[model samples]
Target: MMNWNMTMKRNKLTVLIPPTPDNVNASEWWPVKSDVNWIETVYSDNKPAPSKLQGVDVFIGTDFTYEMAKFADKLKAILIPAAGYERIIADALPNGAVVANASHHEAPIAEWVMMVAVALDHKLLQSHKTFVTGLWDHWPGRYGPYRELFNRTFGIIGFGAIGRRVAKLAKAYDMEVIASGRSNNHSQIAQSLGVKYCWGKQGMKEVLSRSDFLLVATPLIPSTLNLIDEQALASMKKTSYLINPARGNIVNEYALYQALKEKKIAGAAIDTWYKYPTEETDQPRPSTHPFWELDNIIMTPHHSGGTDGTRNRRAQTVAENIDRLTSGQPLINVIDF
Candidate 1:
């Protein structure tokens, strides 16, 4: 078992769970309540009152705004139920508080990535749309031959947990997997997975130019923002398809739109977006550009990894961490700013 210096003297820990869409019906999956030592409090709104947050030992939510932090006087840990911590204002967190995130989303997200890759390569959505409209242009004899994933080069940017999972799945399809990251730290692991890995600008160029299907799986950080700009997009093969299950800004929004409009690349599958619905506007456009006008793109509302399995596993992880906090054990997946 892991160990930590900090331990709660209280018999029970108050865990405040907000009513975010991701946290819907969380009581069904959270296992800690049965333990009797953990108290689970479900807030009615995404933004809870200061009174709701006071004395809370744990806050189980994704968005940790400054306002939430201002009232979190007794918070021990802010356990995000998901991997992405970009929404969290780490600077706003109170002293002695630790932030942690969970990652059971790799499998589901990899599945979505591969699914969309095959769909894009096969032109499945386009074909379906045309065929359903009584058009026979997509007929095997009428249309040009479709591409198969077999023996194709699958390039991945940011070879982290999700990228590793994607590489395994792509390899299962007999794809030639090649990946690049910020450093050579995961080089050996990539090699063991039969992936050709490299780093630096030259490595990125090699992956971009050679891939039949390229995947963006890196996190959104300062140096990584707009990593795939107009110049980077121009480096890709015109027939290659881009798959981004990562953040939207990682690929320039306007640049991506322009590329698709000009057929700079064959197509793209984008899950994350530049714009999202806020409290005032529940249905704002996902981007400043009209990507929906393009036929060679596949878009989803950032839910590729929001699977039931991910929810259950994350809930278990949060429960385990809370249990560890009460038991004076070191937590897993702790994030340091």
Candidate 2:
């Protein structure tokens, strides 16, 4: 059993859960009304207004803008429900306040990456389409050039939680793993996971050239914007596949479209997009480019990490962290302080 230190500060702490749309019932996921103060406030639907942030000790949600930071005078911590907090300005946050984000997204997303990698390598979608078109009987060699994941090289960019999980899954399929990241402290962890640790641009190039399947799982920032541009794509193996489960902006949409359209690489599997629907009913397309017309690419609706298991784990982490904060203990998943 987990020892929950709920005996401290339960009465005085006021947790603020901002209002969301009908599709997202914040109350259903958050803690119900109890002796512990749980305050429900609506702020710009998605973003919390400055006026509403006053006197709040802890803020739970994603959309914390720089403008909102000015009003968070009493804020001690900001807890995000998911792993990505690039939207929140870390430096602008009030002094003494910590920024933390959560994710049980790594496991499910890693599984999805492996599944798509194998599917692309084996030409699963094209083969299935060939059968559907009634050409399998006539064409014996249509799917003859399929590849296997066994003994192949797998490369991962941004060796964080999600990237590390991908390395572990790739190893299970007898793959050689290599990864590049900003920090080199994880060399020991890489060794334990059977991953070759690399750093800097030259190391990134080495991984891209050698990998049969290259995955982009890095956080989106100013430096990572268009990280996989024309030059980077040109360096990859012509037979290799690209798998991006990270933010859409990390890979340039136009460059990716051109690469896949011209067969610069074998194919690509994209779960994130450059554009999204502003309103639920807007139904906007994922990209400006005609990527849907490509036969070699696999496109998903950014649901690689949306499993129930991931949701439960995320909720557990949030609940536990809230308890920890109330108990005057160190918080979990702190990204900035």
RMSD of each: 4.0, 4.2
Q: List the residue pairs that clash in candidate 1.
A: 3-330
> How do all models score by TM-score?
0.90, 0.87
How many residue-pair clashes does candidate 2 contain? 0
**Local distance difference test scores for all models:** 0.86, 0.83
Superposition-based RMSD of candidate 1 using all C-alpha atoms, in angstroms: 4.0
Per TM-score, the best of the predicted structures is 1
Q: What is candidate 1's CA lDDT for residue 229?
A: 98
Q: Which candidate gets the maximum lDDT versus the true structure?
A: 1
What is the per-residue lDDT of model 2 for residues 196-291, given as tens digits with 9 covering 90 to 100?
999888888888888889999899888899999999999999999999999999998899999999999999999999877654367778999989
Model 1 TM-score is: 0.90
